[model samples]
Target: MTNLQKAVILITGASGGFGQELTRQLLEAGSRLILTDINEAVLRQRVAAIQNEVKTGEVLACLASDLADVQGCETLYHQVKALDIPIDILINNAGVGLFGRMDEIPRQRWEYLMQVNLMTPMRLSALFVPDMIEHQKGHIVNISSLAGWCAIAGMAHYSASKFGLRGFSEGLFNEVKDYNVKVTAVYPFFSRTPILQSERFGTLAKTYQGLPEHMITDPADVMRATIQGIVKNQLHVFPDPTANRLHLLQRYFPQLVYWINNRMGRSMKHG
Candidate 1:
């Protein structure tokens, strides 16, 4: 189990919906943070806004870097390494949302999505894992989604990227165990995050608007569970109760999930 108190943690996408809340909680847990995001201005803004709560969590560095491409990830890695700080925890929390049919969304966009969601984490992990192995202790928490467990309408490519992340994270967990390095893949269903307002293309926007209030979760609840899981060195975390139910259903009754997706997708395709 990793003790977060005074642990050096580097979090990507530190300016987004999930990133911001996770940052606050990590800070409150007494973890020193190295926060990064693609947008420099927004990153700075977020760090400033959270200053009041930083008494417990030290802000080591607020470097801004894009993770959408290999170069970006490489440069960010180098920047962090140059700081001469060893990271105890690496949170690959940065990701974007794409909503549309395969043909409706441009191929390049999915390519970008793949880079940010799957390959960027893979690249960053490759860059940082050796150091953790050498240190003989570290944790890597990947924020995946429930969509990774099952396909979803208007998000086929998104699901693919998450599925890839889940597989890679789980594999890394095993490979790095002997070295005392840990990996956890977190799957959260839709919550009240900005991702819910993600850009849509040929999509039925009302589908999310129509979801029962109980089905969507509170982001705080998800992150709290994630933090608790991190402390236990848990491998897979289904943070939301509803999402947990869906995960089990997806595992045992996949056809039902697929059918639900198909029904929603038809509306996105035709509505």
Candidate 2:
């Protein structure tokens, strides 16, 4: 099992709902943390709060850097490198969501989403993997979503980004397994997180309206399962029960899953 105590972890998107929850839990587990977010004030506030609550683990650094561009990624890497801390784990939890028909969504918005959700993780991994390989130990966690496994309407761009993340995580896991490095791709269904509060387009909000209240998972529960998955070195994690069941169905009954999603897509369009 991976020991989080004293482990130095770098978490992107540290100001978001899921990111904050993960930070809380990992800090409680006695892991040193480096938190990064685009919002400098918010990130500092979060670090201060965690410091107040948990006294065991150190909050090494709180960085405010955009992950939506290559330059931002490079800046963060250089900043962390300057600190001289060897990250034992890297959590690529930063992402953005775009909701609308493929044609209706602005090209720039979806492009930004892809950059933040897909390219940022790849870039960050490229920066840290070499050290992890040299040390022969580390873990990388990528927060993907259920949309990656089962695509639906009004989420064409969002789903594509998540799909790309999952694919990259899987490939990276295989590539680095021999070095004793673990990679986990977390696939959570809709969660009660700030991502849900992101601006919606067209009928996308209407589509979410159709989902049952119980369908939205809790951020804390998802983070708990995510931590467990990290400790056990699981390659793929379905943090919510619905996500796990959906993954099983997608595996055993691909056509059925496709048909169900197709029907849901039609409902979203008609309503």
Candidate 3:
């Protein structure tokens, strides 16, 4: 079991709903952390508010950076490196959401989403994995969505980004494990996070609210499961119950899943 007590960790997207919850839990678990987000003001405010509750775990720094560009990722890497901390855990938790017809979403908007959701994670992992390998003791956690496992309609671009993240995490896990490093890909379905408030493209785009209330999860629940998975050294973690059920259906009833997706896609065009 991986002990989080005093573990040096870095979390991207540390100001978002899921990231905030994860940050609090990690701090409570006695893990030292370096937090980063795209918004500097919000991140600093978040850190300031949490300082009173901090008991054992330390917040190393709240370095904010835009993770959409390769240069931004490299800059964040260099900033963290300058802090002189050997990060034990790197959580690629930052992501954006998009909802629209495959062709309706603007090219640049979807492209920006891809860079933030997929490219940033790939870049950050590449920057940090070498240090983890050298240490022979570390964990890299990718916060992928269930959409990555079971692709659906009205979210082709979002699904594609998540699919890429899941794929990268899968390969990276194997590549670094020989060095005694750990990697975990976390899949949570429809959590009640700011991503749910993500910008929509088409006027008739389906929203996460369309799903049944039971299908939406709390960010805290999802992040709690993610932390537990890390402690257990799990490779692939489905934090929500719905994620597992859907994964099984997708695996054992592939045609049925495809047909459902087709119907949904058809309805999006008509509805």
Candidate 4:
């Protein structure tokens, strides 16, 4: 409903590429952070890095749990509750991108991708939304992708999950705006995050072609734009200028989008 003062924010995938940047920026902005990741050692190391190098904020808690699992979500919720901290912001940014044709991807891998990208966010939002409604204030930031709006070959599962996340964010925005709970869906273009290097469906693939300079977004810029959006209560945050334009183009001229996508697909295939 209003700007958060000394907000207690919980971020999932704290050790992730964007997660680390988000934590640093939030600390700079003076938020009491609660961070979690499936990788415990990496999580602890990152927490230490932030606390040692950055201005210390309120309780900086880190925990380990596989958010892709339902029980893991329950365990994480309980652990945070035990801390007895009120949550003012929930960032569901832990996600994976898989590159493979629909039939080429294993069912198990697709399920895991869906759970991490879609189900975990949905579950956590369900857990925390009631509290936000009771307090009549909170922020939900879902880190979706540009793939949500435009289709790309070999990214069927990834695109589906983001599409679901985007739809969820929009519906939640309309559902909770009257209650003063703000929801922001972020659609970021390709970033230089480790996700791009991850092995998908058995092998690694360079799904896009561009210099690292041009292909990846600066994490700091994404964080700045996202926090600004939250403070301004913006419904959508397009972290890249190119991504924003693509979204506009898709909305007004979908046929043009398909034409461009076809050309890009050819380039990727030929390259």
Tens digits of per-residue lDDT for model 4, 1-271: 3354588999998898899888888887778989999988999997888778787565458888899988988898889889887688999989987776788778999899999999999999988888899998888989999998987777889999999999999999999988878898899887878887654553224444522356568777877787888788788889888789889999999999989888767676555
Q: Write the per-residue lDDT of candidate 1 for residues 1-271, one digit (tens) a residue.
A: 7899999999999998889888899988999999999888889888888877566878989997978888899999999999999999999999888887677778888899999999999999999999999999899999999988987767889999999999999899989999999999999988888887667666444443434556578988899998898899999999989678889988899888878777755644444
| Model 1: residues with Cα > 4 Å off, grouped in runs | 203-212, 259-271
What is the lDDT ranking, best to worst?
2, 3, 1, 4
Q: After aligning candidate 2 to the native by TM-score, how far in Å is the CA of 25 from where it should be?
A: 0.1
Compared with the true structure, what per-residue lDDT tens digits does model 2 show for residues 86-185? 9999999999886777887778888999999999999999999999999999999999999989888778888998999999999999999999999999
Candidate 2 wrongly placed segments (more than 4 Å): 203-210, 262-271
User: For each candidate, what TM-score against the reference?
Assistant: 0.93, 0.94, 0.93, 0.93
Instruction: Give stretches of model 3 more than 4 Å off.
Output: 206-209, 258-271
The number of residue pairs in model 3 that clash at the backbone is: 0
Per-residue accuracy of model 3 over 1-271 as CA lDDT, tens digit each: 8889999989999999988988899999999999999888999898777777766688899998999998999999999999998999999999999887778889999999999999999999999999988888888999998899777766889999999999999999889989988999998988888887677767546432355456589898889998999999999999989887777778899888788777655654554
Judged by lDDT against the true structure, how good is candidate 1?
Answer: 0.87
Q: Could you say which candidate leads in lDDT?
A: 2
The ten-residue window of minimal lDDT in model 2 covers 203-212
Q: After superposition, how far is residue 232 of candidate 1 from its true place, in Å?
A: 0.8
